[model samples]
Target: MDPRFLGIPELTTEAPSVAVVVDVMRACTVAAWAFARGAERIVLTGTLDEALALKARHPDWAALKDGPPAPGFDLVNSPGQLRSADLGGRTVVQKTTAGTVGALAVRDASLVLCAGFVVAEATARVLRERAPDEVTYVVTGEDGRADEDLACAQYIAGRAAGGSPDPAGYLRRAAASRAAAELTQGVRRGSHPDDVALCLELDRFPFAMVAAEEDALLVLRRYDGNP
Candidate 1:
């Protein structure tokens, strides 16, 4: 069967066997870059305070939030910042505005994965390999009105359905989105200029980011296994 697309995460019920959350503007892109940089694992939190508290307790883990780095956090949730950090074997605590919240809201799904243009192809491959009876694509940005996330979700959903969708076309739509404009504004303010470009790097990672509950906390990690 074809994949189901969701807008408001809070109202989602009876989620399919697999749920793929997309936040192409930044959150999922950040995850892809962090894993690419060799971060051990990412602990996703809904609030900045929760992430900061976790960082305080761990002391060794890297803390990141949506905008600029907070007092207790190490960096912002930007791919450019993650690319420079030596995240090798370090745990990352992350709090974002939409991505992590949408992810954690998904219930009754056997597998929950995060996706952006960076890992879109890899995520589709994983879905095709697993071949779940049902799949749900959660566009976790601006109640699914965010063009970047919606475009990325459409691309992945098409690929998972055995179609060769033109990623360049999707990229164009994503670039014209409000989220992209926000990133551009962020760059002008010296908030990681490279992030705007980095988030659009299609198929940059070959691994998928999977989220699961561990020790009562939502944890994200790379899943590079065959079905």
Candidate 2:
């Protein structure tokens, strides 16, 4: 059957045959890197305090916390930082404004896969192979509302189920936004432009990491790589 889309609230009762959680702004991208770098697991939490608590309790596990700036934490939801860190044989606990929360919201799915624009093709290929009875794409939004998440959902939904995505249009808009931002005026002018460029590379990592509650973290690795 074709894959379907559902918001987080809709996930309360209806258990998805397979659910893919997306936070394209950064979280899922970082998770992908963590998996690539040999991270055993990643615990995704909604609050920084919860992540910190997890870290304190499990000192053996390498904990990395991320969220909005106002309420600070160990990290600031940047994929660059995650890539730079050596996560070999470590378990990262992530807290983000939207991504990790979205993962937690889809607590009822039989199988959950983390996704983002970076791994969109990989995600669709996995869905096609699994061909689950039903598929739900959950887009975790900032401030508990949909915008980029929904746009990304629409893009993936079209691809996974045999439709079309306006890739050019989307790229144009994204480029326009970046062009509009006068970064030179900012305090940190030359900060990590390569990082943003790296995040835009589609399907750089040939994997889809799934969250495992047995260890309360994502099990890193590839999903089959067959598209």
Highest TM-score among the candidates is held by which one?
1
Q: Which stretches of candidate 1 lie over 4 Å from their true place?
A: 187-190
What lDDT, from 0 to 1, does candidate 1 have?
0.84
lDDT of 1 by residue, 80-135 (tens): 77788888999999888899888888744689999999998889998889888778
lDDT of 2 by residue, 132-197 (tens): 767777866543244445555666666777666766555443333332132212322322445445
**TM-score versus the correct structure, for each prediction:** 0.94, 0.77
Clashes of 1: 0
Q: Which ten residues in a row have the lowest lDDT in candidate 2?
A: 179-188
**Alpha-carbon lDDT of model 2:** 0.62
How many angstroms is residue 61 displaced in model 1 relative to the true structure, after the best TM-score fit?
0.8
Clashing pairs in 2: 42-217, 42-218
Provide the overall lDDT of each model, using Cα atoms, as 2-decimal numbers.
0.84, 0.62
